[model samples]
Target: MMASNPAILPGDVAREIIAPESYAAWDPLLDTFDHLRDTMPVAKVVAEDDVFEPFWLITRYDDVMRISKDNKTFLNNPKPVVFATREATEFARAATGSNMLVDSLVVFDAPIHPKYRKLTQDWFMPRNLKLIEGEIRALADKLVQAMIDAGPDVDFVKHVAAPMPLHVIMQILGIPEEDEPRMLMLTQQMFGGQDADLSGSGMENMTPEQVLELVSGAVKNFEEYFAGIAAERRANPTDDVASVIANATVDGEPLPDRDMAGYYIIMAAAGHDTTSATMSGAMLALARDPEQFARVQADRSLLPGLVEEAIRWTTAVQHFMRTAAQDVEIGGQQIKKGDWLMLNYVAANHDPAQFEQARSFDASRSPNRHMAFGAGAHQCLGLHLARLQIRILFEALLDRIDSVELAGDPVRSSSTFVGGLKTLPLRFASQ
Candidate 1:
């Protein structure tokens, strides 16, 4: 049988890196990806199971940067930012008559993508976020107080990290405070499908097909909810992100239902989780290395670097998929047309050639243009908002938290995508 196609090529290493269980097995993946970055650089993932596609796993700093920046050749349209499980892909195709990928800015390529992004582009600009700084700061302060009230030993994820970003993003979207819980639940189900603890679907006995149904159900709920919001906003306009989506028009036409809802969902899901993960990682880093915490506490100027470092270190939004439109060569490997490739941000961020001490957490590393927020055209739209939130929160945190240390072994969400610690138990010397 043609020698069984030689198992395609990059072997068990690639498989381990993307494996869902490996999400909790953090250090092993770091080590494996580090080896691949150093050795293979741009390696084709040898596909063993039929769950994932056989494609290039660009591990090096240069290769990832190139692919991420060159959005045209490696298009995000059709199949964007993730290699879906075969079942999910088929489900989406059958249900929506499209790929399982959601069509947001991250999922769209040029031309149409730019126009769609332009709708709320100004709203997310630094100037706009600055206008709402006071509101966000007040929200952050309230969350800090809530954390303080929770007392000596608290699950940081449950008390602070999770709620803080959810509140901020919800406020931005003009979502009622009461609806925050619903938003959180839907987001968890969407991105946390791999982690039963976070998915809340009791997925242990469920097969992949069952989990996909759970995920599909969640997406349907989001779509229905956003549709109602879109109608309400159009009828009675408001100043929040929801209103913007409702009134948003592309080339003189109202945005398609899916894109509008996808935009809202992306902001809701991505807005909180990435920020929460980074915050969790930052707190974890500070607890581990008190010296760094003290230094940041002393000089607040280090807040920006701390945020950047945390994003790179955590890499919450792990990988994005791209489809090669034509034959292309990257890192000396020929990428055939229509092949799906994963831009492994985790590996790229830790490439030793790009970062001097890529493994160690360093807040002083200047010129740190890590691909944590991604790069080029599709770089995170909420990057400025995420940065501002982290910067300000740390400023508030360092000022209030007299001391922070881990109270127990932290637990990470078991997911290949959007994974982070679900529970970061910590003992803090409250201010």
Candidate 2:
């Protein structure tokens, strides 16, 4: 076993690396990643109290991209795909008889993954997306008008960023308009448990037990909610994604109850949250730099660059854990069979080796081939939809808003995963 000392991230640094609060403060966390890439990019993160077993942290862009593309060697199954503290894993075992409380596409490996993904794969493709463009534009128009009517001082997260993706996803899922709030609330509890504002638990410093309890409840809510939706869709089939999952089959059999629920949860949660994060991050960048904002406003052709850059800048869905299926070497370190590894997207996205002036937000950055949507088959399924939503919303914003700037301090979500700005206050002038 590797000794837990100065070699890898120190005990304190390892703990902070996984902590929610540390993620809230972006720069300090980047400094830690910068240090890791320079000294030990593939070092083990050892726990002092043994609350969790050690896992290698992959910091470099090349290493992360390699693991992401090669799903066979670095598989998602046989380990918790997301980082979980020892206490949380143990609690999950007791509660659900599994290391993870929820299982979804994010946790599945090949054969099974390919089959399940094929169910709704075509629905999210660019050709299908064109059919919904009018609806999206209409939503954008209504939302942008609402923002204009909302006065000069507006919380961008509340008024614009959060709702655009949420509504788009909900419409695609065949969920009723009235149920949108419930869906958003449930998602917040699931992904935002560490944030006091998002979790609604009324406690900021929650215990491991409390966090697990809240997460479990949210999962239960999502499962119960989607079960009914699944049943409805199966009975009265529609062209929506929920119908596809409800009627999907693998090996000539319907998906098991748990797998079906997992499908719905991933579709419902990851479907909207990550896009919202990128949208908010993009707005934050424009609000801070008026020149780029004016540039994009003058030349509408820069919209695609703006969207791509924001996706890279935020890199929501930060890290996904992959267990080594066999002995392999990466970044000058020998990794053994069955060892767990973290593909740190945030670190890779910011690596100077990959991105020039990695800190500066470039709306017109070229060759931006970022791993923000991940790589290979496991890449984010909603990527095209995310890009479309951001583009359409910004088009609407450019049409209505003459100028914009930050009204106050913007705050970020306290989560190491599925994170971006949660509170972005902006002052805008109507065109």
Candidate 3:
């Protein structure tokens, strides 16, 4: 076990916090982090049984901010950004001949990341998104109506939050409506496999090897499906994201099939999972604090605050892993070259030094520059679209929903990397 003292104690804590099966047990890690922030902000996280490398877990807001912004020093290229279990890492590397986690845009450094990001940069800008604002608003309205039709008591996660972004992203990508269910299913298998219901493979009781087997099967299905889609886009192009991906080039050359597959997978899966989690987190916060909900409902102007607060509060996309290119010092701690460090975004988002009342969910949090979408070059490409989607969806909900209450038990996804509520049951009264 890692050090039994200081920041993180040796126990089931690492498993509970970083493992997929224990994602539902949230507050323990948060509480431990609250202590770590003060005691040892950048402490080594040794896993149980030495199954994973001991990573420097940076929890303080300032340190995380510094590391994320200093892309030149704390590079994202040449490695995976999200820490994988050693077993999964070995299996993926063996199967793919390269680390599967090391392929995506988020895992690349300058020159490459910049070039790849530029391909679809203009498409996500506010002006471009403005063109789709009406369409999005209409979709949001339709989604809210669907929720209302589901009756007063609905699992908001299923009825409202989960489906809205999936439909929107699939539309933008020009995927068929019939395929939406399949896409969502694959997304759950990819991101929420830690949970029993979401994984579809009963990950709640599976060994790490079994879990990877499930993930491998899902990845195979996604690759086959997207390959067919890419070919179609090639044969008959359209003004959609899939078409954009199919036609994109870097350095006057086409992206390799594997990289292209990773891009599509990230967009399709991360797009919905992260957004849905944030939406559920926001709704959960609002549900818990009716006064805040009433304030936002009464004043539409507060919608942005609500959205930002939700992003910060949820911190859906948790930690990003960075490997040291050379020896460096961060937060007054020495980091050796080739070392793995976890920029724990959730911990950073709630750092007391950066945010006042960081533990409390304040809808009116001013100067809220949380690193929920990350910082610098690798900042989330879909951030604008995410914000636009959330704001529009909330606008629709505020117009129709007058009040909400917890209908039943709410459950968080059992995913260490992308954590949020999987089942958010709620009862709301319509306006």
Worst 10 residues of 3 by lDDT: 1-10
What does candidate 2's lDDT look like per residue over 1-431, in tens digits? 43334256788889888898888898999999998999888888998888887999999999999999998899998888989988888877887777788888888899899988888889999999999999999999998889888879999999988998999999999999999999999999999998999988874677778888999999999999999999999999998998999998899999999999999899888999999999999999999999999999999999999999999999888899999999888887888899999898999999999999887899889889898999988998889999999999999998888889999999998998889999999999997
lDDT (10s digit) by residue, model 3, range 155-180: 98888899999988888888899999
- Put the candidates in TM-score order, highest first: 2, 1, 3
TM-score of each: 0.96, 0.97, 0.95
Model 1 Cα lDDT, one tens digit per residue, 363-390: 9888798999888889899999988888
Model 1's number of clashes is: 2
Which pairs clash inside model 2?
A: 51-86
The 10-residue segment of model 1 with minimum total lDDT is 1-10
* 10 residues in a row with least lDDT, candidate 2: 1-10
Q: Candidate 2 — which residues are off by over 4 angstroms?
A: 1-6
TM-score leader: 2
